[model samples]
Target: MANPTRRLEESESEGFVISGKDIGLRMKALEYWKCAELGLQSNPNCAVQSFKVVIAEALPNQGPNQIDTFLSEHGGPGIQHIGLHTSSMSGTIKKLKLHGVEFAEPPATYYSEVGRLHDILGVGQDVQELKELGILIDTEEEGECSKSPRYLLQKFTKPLFDRDTFFLEIIQRIGATGFGSGNITALWRSVQAYMNEKHHPEKS
Candidate 1:
């Protein structure tokens, strides 16, 4: 989306160039989650390959927000979260909770909606456990309504750092390859809402 108006000559610019302030650059949130994942496999067709690594970045929101405060406290851009993979989200959440790990609570009505419940059960996940554990679920190709549904289950832990800067995401992908927008927005909003309630940071 960035079209540079001019390029700096070899002698005119440093290694980095901060772009000009112009239109069409509006962003709402103060920070966003970025994740990179790698799979290690002995050979192709390996049913389940080991996940070598998953890098997560929490960049400060471009506009005026509390994430800017977090970044300032963090000494610049840094990893604020990590997504851990799990095969059974319900079981994992149950065990983690029993051991005293607190997960972020999604909207209370997240499971109350009938359509959302349908999607969760359609993907062959247990709706009762998901609702009880405050887990978020999302899938694609809703219109097609294939007998087999590809969906993802995700839940976030409360901020691990002293500040509301770092947290962990527990994710389970059932035939889903990419992150779901619904889940991402839900996660971001939940964090923002929590921060606003706890810190009451000034907004520009």
Candidate 2:
């Protein structure tokens, strides 16, 4: 097990990376986001309910050393995961898992304590449903008074070259109309934890 970031850096140093093209794609994505905003503002009934994006290290089947070569040729820093919206996250997760979809394991506490938090935040979702799917919920503030319910569901597996790439996130929005800004930090923390475990299995 090796640190994924460290591995990426090492690969770069070894002249096997994709840097420039990745940057170009990111810039393009930013432009797309801007345009999407404008389009949404212009048309209220536009098809903007949900969208999915995947950002991951390039897959091996894409080419021999394509990921490394691409990263080496370009200053690689891009998306490596996708988010899919689902009417029923539980059903979706179960089906995806059955179909060989991999997921990252969030801390058990994320599942156990989220229900109490959801109740406090007044979110209208079934906590048990989330738990059954091994989803994790997070909020920005801690303690009794804070009541904003934003959550992150993560799962991990060795795919696309013995490296953790794609992950599935199931989001059920009640009042929020966009990605949960408050829960990002928590998601990052969970990712870091997964990476650490992947890099140091002995410790686990």
The candidate that achieves the highest TM-score relative to the unseen native structure: 1
User: All models: lDDT?
Assistant: 0.61, 0.44
User: Candidate 1: where are CA atoms >4 Å away?
Assistant: 1-73, 142-147, 200-204
Instruction: Give model 2 RMSD, 1 decimal.
Output: 11.1
Worst 10 residues of 2 by lDDT: 21-30
Compute each candidate's TM-score over C-alphas: 0.62, 0.51
| C-alpha RMSD between model 1 and the true structure | 10.5
Residue 202 lDDT (model 1): 66
Instruction: Give per-residue lDDT, candidate 2, residue 58.
Output: 46
Candidate 2 off by > 4 Å: 1-45, 48-75, 112-116, 119-121, 138-168
Candidate 1 C-alpha lDDT tens digits along 1-204:
222222222122232122222211112222222221334433433434334332233333344333454577578777667778898888899999999997778766667654687787777777887778889997766435455677888999988877667889898887665444455545655776676666775641
Model 1 clash tally? 2
State each model's C-alpha RMSD to the native: 10.5, 11.1
